[model samples]
Target: MSAATLLRDVFGFDGYRPGQQEIVEAVTTGKNTLAIMPTGGGKSLCFQLPALVRDGVTVVISPLIALMRDQVRGLKEAGVVAGALTSGNTEEETDEVWRNLENGTLKLLYMAPERLASNGAQRMLRQAGVSMIAVDEAHCVSQWGHDFRPDYLRIGDLRRDLDVPLAAFTATADEETRIEIVEKLFDGHAPTIFLQGFDRPNIHLAFAAKDGPRAQIINFANARKEQAGIVYCGTRAKTESLAKALRDARHSACHYHGGMDADDRRNVERRFQQEDGLIVCATIAFGMGIDKPDIRWVAHADLPKSIESYYQEIGRAGRDGAPAETLTLFGPDDIRYRRQQIDEGLAPPERRAADHGRLNALLGLAEALHCRRQNLLSYFGEDPAPCGNCDLCDKPADVFDGTTPVRMALSAALRTEERFGAGHLIDILLGNMTEKVAQRSHDQLPTFGVGKEYSRVQWQAIFRQIMGHDLMRPNAERHGALRMTPKARPILRDEATIDLRRDTIKSAKSGPKIKQMVSEEDAPLLSALKAKRRAFAEQLGGPAYIVFNDKTLIEMAEKRPKSLDDMARIGGVGTKKLDSYGAAFLAVINGEAAAQHPQRQKLAGRNDGSIYDRLLETQATLSRGPSGTDKPMSCSASQLAKVASQKPRDEAAITRLLGDRAADRFGAAFLDILRDA
Candidate 1:
């Protein structure tokens, strides 16, 4: 079949996203290619579609077992024959995959690079008639990439042995990674490269100087209530603390990190996939290969490691092409912390310097006077015009002449023997009487108290802006000591005037106000619904979110659906759910309805025909032997209870309301049973 036919038949996408068609065509023509597309830019299909059209088996080398499993599952769901070999599989499972590969039943095989590092595995690949090698996260081969895997370095040997055209793909990479991939993976040969534009217009980018980051996150979450999202933090502790803070603020938030057990991570992933309005507060570990498309926003509670990491993390949002939002909260300390990490890392001196440069690019992003999106795209070699979507473009900054403060800060750094850090230098400028200052007695210098005209906070802000401007450098060895660069010398010598934008500190009061917009009576119903969800979650031994999300409950409370049809119309209630719990919830609604409006009491009995038996049989059949009753389907009993209590419905409504899973498993069968009844 043609590429377009394969695209429509297998993946169901009407056309290729930008750069996908070219990469697919390159691979189909048997040429080695390196494709660097942004996250959510359809990178997987560039190789997957070509694999289908190509003659031989396409061996995909991926980094994570979870990622491989997810891809395999998605391909299988789309009726494509795919399999993955990972440590998580049982012996029989591995045997089945191998059998399929040997018998030519599987078109694509995904295994980790570590698997290929074994000699026996390499022999197996040779015997399997491997046609081409597709490396996902190709940046891992580059020492310069944020997430470098040493095992990936061995793929170069695999490429030589296979002697087939190889295709490598990554969502984020810099010039250093591009060179490293070509050198290491393609054996020093340049491949057909495609660098797709890294702009995501659906995402509204904004940065907040770190002040009450938790409060700001809460405000943002509340404003966009009932949306699936992620909140990334630098530390595991921060993830836990911020998640707790969000939960305390009544947002349905959970924490995930590498420190958690694998089972817990799996649970988090499942919740993120199945539920809506869940805010996953996590480290970068949480989002490498997630495919959920409806995420509405991504927030950074701490600065990310690099610009590439930042882009990949935020690119998770707005995957469905809907307008989403991103918020990054950073402070000066984040820069210092990142600098210390780069300096202390085991990378060679030159690589360390490159890493530091990469971090500076991120700091530059945070401190840019122009559109943040514009600066970010420029770093990737794409010159996008001022995108009116970002915060800077939406609200133009006010520039201030910083000649006096800039000169004073630069001179103070020089006067302190150029040995002091920003804190000490700021103290010298403002003449603070701290112990370090008094001991230096160099607080006695001519520049001491010269900057008293500006407050200590103001001086600190000026120092950040100056460092961001590259007129100064922080000596990493000396613990981030502020030092005047050559760019600062002319300015301090009065030969050049420095103009800086007046730092725009978004007012704490500027966010949307949270009022009790719903009536006081509705508050009780909301609480009751949440309690019910918690009880159901406890009974099922799952997270509170796995039962029914607070957003769904809130919508139920707001709409007060009187019938099963109305309950199914509530945002998260599906057919299986309406069949199971619609009546229970409707009973509560009707109870409240009778109490509030006696005239509606007769209407409750008007739709009392028995529709519960057919739903129970369908549920029983779906839960039949070996599928395991313990492993609940997406719809839980309590969710069904809520639906049944809310609405009484026929099998047609049940199939319609339960969604695709119910429709697929029991639609026609249940319809036949309901007809007989």
Candidate 2:
């Protein structure tokens, strides 16, 4: 049958997806080919159609037994003759595959890359009259690729041994990876390369800074309660603990990692395929082989190791062309951990540098100030318009001219001779009297105390942004010390400016508002309460709700409780919260800042808080009777807060709060402002 007739009769598809037909035509005609398509863009059909149209069986080299078996089952169900040779198969299944191969009834034979390393397997393919070689996950042949398989290097030898034309397919290959794939597989001979667009418009992209990350994951999982999903974690222990946490939250969850037993991992894989709405909390070891198409969502509990890895992992979702969602949670600690992983790897300096660049690409995505799809596609060499599907596009980032802060950071780094990490640099900028600063006399520098307007957390975020901009990078040789790139030169010299997202620095769950947290008026107070919770969480190195959940914080904001007794009466706040958080929350309700002076604390999140400051400024401007000729007089901050809160209607009431002289001096202007408010 022709390719089109075979495509219809065998696979039951109406026609190929965009760009697949050309690849099929190339492969079917025995022109060596390399096709780099997006994950859900149907890379399988490009080879499968060609395999069927060509004569003799096409030996498919897939990475995972599970992936091979899944595809074989699918092809068989479609009435195509397919079988897999893998350790995963039962003896009866292996005998059936051999029978089909000997009888020339098998149109496709799937094998893992490792089998090619054996002479016996190579001889069998030669004897079995294999017409063509189709390599799936072909990027695995590149040592430079994230999912490199050593046995893939032998595919070039296999092709030579069999003297057959080859077709390679992969979803995650940048220019470098593509080059390496060509060199390694085709031996410097260019193939018919099909580089398709990497845009996944159906996948909604999002990111959140890590704050109560467990709660964030739980909330996300609970919201989409009955959908199948995958949660990729960075470590094995995390997968297990997070899986248990999900179970406690009453979701059907399981953990998978390289550390798990073979049987257990296989069982998890089997269950994931057979069961709907099962979430597999796993490390990178899990998703590469999963062929499930209805995975409704994918979340990264921690940042993936690189951008390529991230794209491939999230691509596992929405494979059926339905809308899929993804959330990647990142933090300063995650950045450090990722950097350390790269530094500790044994890759050469150049490759390590490339790896760092890949990581920087991911950081840029996390801190993206535009549509996430735009940023993602731009990395893969596509220039697409804004996709109104990401969190940023839904609500454009709150951005500010961060040029001043960026310069301040670069100046501190340069003045320190580029020897310090973010912590010491932040200390120098904030003028902290740390022993290291005293020993190095960095506190005496000009940049010291210049950044006190921002907190340490905020500065860390700025440093992350600098790295994300590729204006600065971590020095692996110097133990992750900061180093400036030429990109920072103009910014440091005051010739260039930068804008940063203001909302991301606030919290991770800063996206679409959580439901029923508080009334509109009480939202700010609830936010302040969450900030306090985050502070405590950061200190304890725990998730935010270790102190109090949102419900409790929502209560605190709404009640505006006055004392420990009042706090104890709220739900979720028992004796422990009364003792531990009561004082701090009471202070917040009384309009207190964490470190600000008592007077300024009253000015937080309250209308009068702002009005009180406006009154002070109005008093200052008119203190000398608006001309500097009259006597100077002022109202205390408390007196200003009282007057602003009471909003005295006339001079008689104003005089009661502020003495007659001070009140008479500032009353008229204050009344006008208060009346308007």
Could you say which candidate leads in lDDT? Answer: 2
Query: What's the true lDDT of residue 80 in model 1?
Result: 80
lDDT tens digits, residue span 1-677, model 1: 89999999989989877778888999989899999988888888988999999876889999876678788889999988888888877698788888888788788999989887789999988988889999999999988789999999988899899899999999888787899999999988899999888889999999888777789999999999899989999899999999999889888999999899888888888889888899999998888768888899999988998889999999999988899999999875566557656654545545755666677678778878888888899888888888889999988777777888888888887777776667678777887888778887866788888877766556666766786677776543332345566778789889998767675422212223336424332543454455556656778899977766778877887777876556766877775565555566666555432121122222232231233434555667675423555444444444344334445246557655667775556555555555654
lDDT of 2 by residue, 1-677 (tens): 89889888887888988998888899989999999999899988888888888889899999887688779988999988899999878899999999999999999999999988788998899989999999999989887777779999999999888889999998899888999999999999999899999988899999988778999999999999989999999899999999999999999999999887778888999999999899999998888678788999999999998888999999999999999999999876677667756754655556666777788889999988888898888888889999999999998889888899899999999999987778789899999998779999998899999999988778878878888888887654343357888899999878888988777555422234435455433543455566567777878999988899888887877777764546666788866565567678777566442343345454444566567767777888998897789988888877877887788898898888888788778888999888877
Off by over 4 Å in 2: 439-441, 506-677
Native-referenced Cα lDDT, model 1: 0.77
Q: Model 2 clash tally?
A: 1
The positional error of residue 105 in candidate 2, measured at the CA in angstroms, is 2.7
Q: Give each model a TM-score.
A: 0.70, 0.72
* Model 1, position 378: C-alpha lDDT score: 86
